[model samples]
Target: MSIDITWGRGDGAASVSTVAELDATLDTISRAHTEHLPYCVTLIAPGRGEFPVMLDICIGHPERSFVYHVAADGSSAWGYQPDLEPGPPFTFDYAGSPTDAWPERTRVTDATARQAARQFLTSGGQRPPALTWETVE
Candidate 1:
């Protein structure tokens, strides 16, 4: 979902003031190469026990594309990621959106991360009966 839509909950966990802080942290936690993984986070929400939700923007767009979902705090965030293409038709639904653009040789990357993000948001997490890791939501 669009982070600008403004999540109605979790306002206290944000410690970073800018997207840089959040992105840098995510970079460290992420095992994917910085070149391949361009998705950087901004705000953060640590759950009491479950994964935290993040609020962030894309490095290039700085507008429409922002992520808001229940993901693990740090780089291990469990969330969705769409195909990120450059120029025109810039929207969160596009940039950061997932596609079949990945390769079959990759083994060390966190392949399931994007799909996880998609499921969580669609289910309206932070509520009861969280989405399962298997279902498509």
Candidate 2:
């Protein structure tokens, strides 16, 4: 299955089928952030039925991300706290929205962030087993 990736204020999203392709696209997103454009990478994976699972990743110092199961009943979950300090929200620009934010409690190191992304991609959007998660909203 292919995953759709989007970043910055662009409406266009790239469809990638392999981990290598996802990594390359993530590299581009990281470079964009390095240039001071705070954009989050959003990944959409095909789920069971109508709605697809979504993973939004804000890759920066204390990278942050969350996964939404997107069930038919509209329930969702988040990437739970992984022993990180519950610091203030890290604000960023995401798809034309300047107020997009993620809490530091959901933060992880760069390596951990990459691993989470890989897990999501490889598992076809399943909540990553390598990371702690909690059902919310």
Candidate 3:
């Protein structure tokens, strides 16, 4: 998941804001993923005001990935789910929909995921994989 940024690319191949916290969350959730929790949920931008963020989780239990859109307050909604298919992994409509789905997507790692959250909060409705979420919370 590579996003075209104009301000130049960042080092470590991750453009997120909080690396330590995101890593901690990922580490905590990775353990949960192997446990009974099939969903393997993790906190993307937890405990924020009415800003807006997105959470994408890839679980190994059922072998599926989920995308969620969370608002600034405390509201959340589904973004895109690929139906758990294995045929070349279809590209979900993350941008340019009647609904503001997650238009901006980040890498499927802890650092990138945090960067994605920051982008979502500051996106204000941008392009590609960033239109999946609306202003709910």
Candidate 4:
């Protein structure tokens, strides 16, 4: 299954079918300022219509980032947050704009984020089992 990965404002879109390609692409996209806007990337298994299942990652920093998943029909959306305890809110560049995730939406390490991305890609956009996902409010 091939997944289309689009970073920033869509200029870095590419399709990857294997884990290695995904890994390499992820590695390239994970770097800040790699693209015109080094904020986030959206992964989609195309041909599912306009609202396809999407896995998005905010890779503003190498060590910490955020993940979000959305169902095709738009019935559900989730954010990965391993820790639920309240903490300082995180602000990062998202699609070229500064966006903030709530304190409850804790940041995750790159390893954790990558694991979730891999799971999402392998499962064809299914909610990743590698991380704890809470419904987006």
Candidate 5:
């Protein structure tokens, strides 16, 4: 069984304001997964001015996944588990009102984000390490 964590920054999205911040976020996630054993973290490089920051985590044993998205506006955060049921895709209208499009993502807090990650891991019979949020510089 393997756990995979992936992260990516948006093109010019302030959600990850600096390269150092991105690296720190990657390090934190990597360290957290180390306790579970045999897990890998992948960082997807972002293009300049990307609109949304993305993070995805997958557990192979029970086969579960969690996806996270932070809007370019920094006004909202989205989390979804795609392995369960079909959900609406996230949308953004760049030409018009960017936030006007979407299936409407649930507003997320730092604690909720951590909780969701922990729950996903635990449901797969994996013990998740303590995870803390790192602010985007």
Candidate 6:
């Protein structure tokens, strides 16, 4: 499956198309956090398929930890606290919602996704850090 993975801290974000790259980026972010540097890493991976799958990782706040999966038919399931062993079961919340759901709701293209993520990183009276981005095929 082709997965578009985007990750970054503060205003800087990058995208990788391979699983290995994703792992390396996550490791780097984790190391920085371990050193007590206040940083937030947001990963947005959108899959192309009949039922498009999307995985988002917001690593910083334990309470904000979640995994969202949406099927081809606009059906979706999500879970919280993914860092925990035996992560919570996925819950469905699209029973009677509009046709346009997540990723779609926010316009899931690379440009828009990156913009939204950067916005989130700098929101709430936070300072914008120098941002760097890279794309891999």
The estimated TM-scores of all candidates read 0.26, 0.79, 0.35, 0.79, 0.27, 0.37
Model 2 lDDT, full chain set? 0.66
**Model 6 accuracy (lDDT, Cα):** 0.36
Q: Write the per-residue lDDT of candidate 5 for residues 1-137, one digit (tens) a residue.
A: 12233432221222333435544554464454443421222222242234432343322212222334333344333354322343234322221223221232323323333454444333331222322222334
Per-residue alpha-carbon lDDT of model 4 for 1-137, expressed as tens digits?
A: 88988875544788998889998888877654644433667888755656788888766454466678887776555555556344356566565566776655555666777788898889887878877766756
lDDT of 1 at 38: 39
Candidate 5 structure, TM-score to reference: 0.27
lDDT of 2 by residue, 46-80 (tens): 65666667776665544454333343345566565
Model 6 per-residue lDDT tens digits across residues 7-60: 332334566555455556556655555434223233433433565444343343
Each candidate: RMSD to true structure?
Answer: 13.0, 2.6, 12.7, 2.9, 15.7, 15.6
Tell me how far candidate 2 lies from the true structure as C-alpha RMSD in angstroms. 2.6
- Any runs in candidate 6 off by more than 4 Å, and if so which? 7-13, 31-52, 62-64, 80-137
Query: What does candidate 4 score on TM?
Result: 0.79
Pairs with backbone N, CA or C atoms under 3 Å apart (clashes), candidate 6: 12-131, 51-72
Q: List the residue pairs that clash in candidate 5.
A: 10-50, 11-49, 11-50, 12-49, 12-50
Residue 92, candidate 5: C-alpha displacement in angstroms? 11
Please name the candidate that would achieve the greatest lDDT relative to the true structure: 4
CA lDDT of 110 in candidate 4? 61
Candidate 3 error regions (>4 Å):
1-17, 40-62, 73-76, 81-137
Candidate 4 Cα deviation (angstroms), residue 2: 0.6
Deviating ranges (above 4 Å) for candidate 5:
9-103, 125-137
lDDT per residue for candidate 3 within 1-137, as digits (tens), equals 22211111121112334435444444554464354332323333333465534354433333234445555555666443222222223222222111221223221333333354445434532211632433334
lDDT of each: 0.31, 0.66, 0.36, 0.70, 0.33, 0.36
